[model samples]
Target: MTELHIRAATPEDLDTVLAFWKVAAEGTSISDDSGGVERLVARDPEALILAERGGELAGTVIAGFDGWRCHLYRLAVHPDHRRQGIASALLAAAEERFVRLGGRRADAMVLTRNETAHQAWGAAGYGPEEQWRRWVKPLTDQVCSAARPDCSG
Candidate 1:
């Protein structure tokens, strides 16, 4: 196995990362588009970490920290690179970033149906929080109406 190189992704990496996710990642996300990822890279250049082996993308992990919370997402290892410590390497880089940024705890969004991921995360010292549930609403450009007072223009 070749040496693994970990680094922060740049604008040039957005397209490649998007394409890689389709093949390596477990599921799709609302923010999987180029625009969304571009915004992420722009907001925090170090948030998207990539692991490359012999110049080929081997794994990726988004270690986003919104000042108060550390959120991990899109942890994907190439099918050919599984069980080779790629995920662990990417996560170590992510955790190191979070700690440097003053983040206390890191949380990951793992799909409930992805049993393989459950085991991986569990082995990485992450477990499901039974008391907390995730709730989300996709933001859109549609104008807010009087009936939906919760939405603002």
Candidate 2:
């Protein structure tokens, strides 16, 4: 196996990143399109981090800092490359980024039903925030019915 290298994603990497997430990630997001990713990279070039080995993508993590808080998303490792510390490497890079940006706390949006991912986050020293709930409103009809009054499926 080739040595793992972690680095910030470039504009040219957007398509590859999207494709990688479809296979490696647990769930999908409304903003997972090319346009959304392009906007993200344009706004914050250092937010999206990637792990590569022998020119193949091994893992990905998005470390977004919105002035006061650090938000992590899409922390995915390819199944073939699991248990090889790729996730840890990506997270280390993210944490380092957060610290450099004056971010005191980091929060990740992990799926509740993903038990394996829960264990991974736990192993990485992150505990679940039982008191907190994620309230969301999808802007796109593809994810939620914007035409409906309550947006219920």
Candidate 3:
């Protein structure tokens, strides 16, 4: 087993990270692109964390802190690397970042249907808030709008 190196992602790692998510991550996000990830790394350099082993990307987690809250996303580990503590290592680093940023609590957006993730998060001391539901409204016209029908401006 190769030693896992956990560290912040660099600009050069953008394409590799995006590609890694396509294979390892359970689902895709609207912002799962080069431009979006580039902006994220540009604005918040430390937000995207990566776990590499023997020069290959093994896992990733986005530990985003916005003033008062620590919001985690994109916790993914390669299929070949499951149960090897890659996810755990990324999370430990994320939690440490949150605490250092004066954050009181940390929250992760996990897909409800991903039972495997639920178990892993539970083991990491996180619990679901069953009463809360996510409500979202896209800010840009690129998002499909039923009422307008033509979102392409």
Candidate 4:
């Protein structure tokens, strides 16, 4: 069995994390915006978790917390690292970290068409919940702008 080290991600790990998410199953939108990750890193570096084997990244999971509940996202394992417990270890570590941060209850969103992911999540103690619909609006021509200040200027 290949030994693995699971730990919170650092800004230096974004490239590796992006590479891992590149091979994720279809319909999964996991962190396409590097700028977003940069912001997330600034807010909470520990939310990103990774598994390393032989000093190489083997798996990754982005875990976020909002005090009441913790959220899991962008879980991926190197094809060569699958079945080696790297993903599981990363997940367990993420959950433990969430608990350490005083979070209760964890949640994750998987694409509806991802049957393989469904099975894995089920095996990991997640169950089928009510159907969820997703909505997205294209911001192709729009730029993210800060809310206007109400102060009289």
* lDDT tens digits by residue: candidate 3, 1-153: 889999999999999999998899876676778988999999999999999999999999999999989999999999999999999999999999999999889999988878999998999999999999887677754464566442222
lDDT of 3: 0.89
How many pairs collide in each candidate, listed in order?
Answer: 0, 0, 0, 0
TM-score versus the correct structure, for each prediction: 0.91, 0.92, 0.91, 0.81
Residue 120 displacement in candidate 2 (angstroms): 0.7
Candidate 2 structure quality by residue, lDDT tens digits, 1-153: 789999999999999999998899987776788988999999999999999999999999999999999999999999999999999999999999999999999999988888999999999999999999888766665665434332221
Task: Report model 2's TM-score to 2 decimal places.
Answer: 0.92
What residue pairs are clashing in model 1?
none
User: lDDT values of the candidates?
Assistant: 0.90, 0.90, 0.89, 0.72
Best by lDDT: 2
Number of the top candidate by TM-score?
A: 2
In candidate 2, stretches whose alpha carbon ends up further than 4 angstroms from where it belongs are 145-153
Which runs in model 4 stand beyond 4 Å of their true positions?
A: 24-30, 131-153
Ranking by TM-score: 2, 3, 1, 4
Q: Could you give candidate 1's per-residue lDDT for residues 93-128 as a string of tens digits?
A: 999999999999999998887899999999899999
Candidate numbers, best lDDT first, in rank order: 2, 1, 3, 4
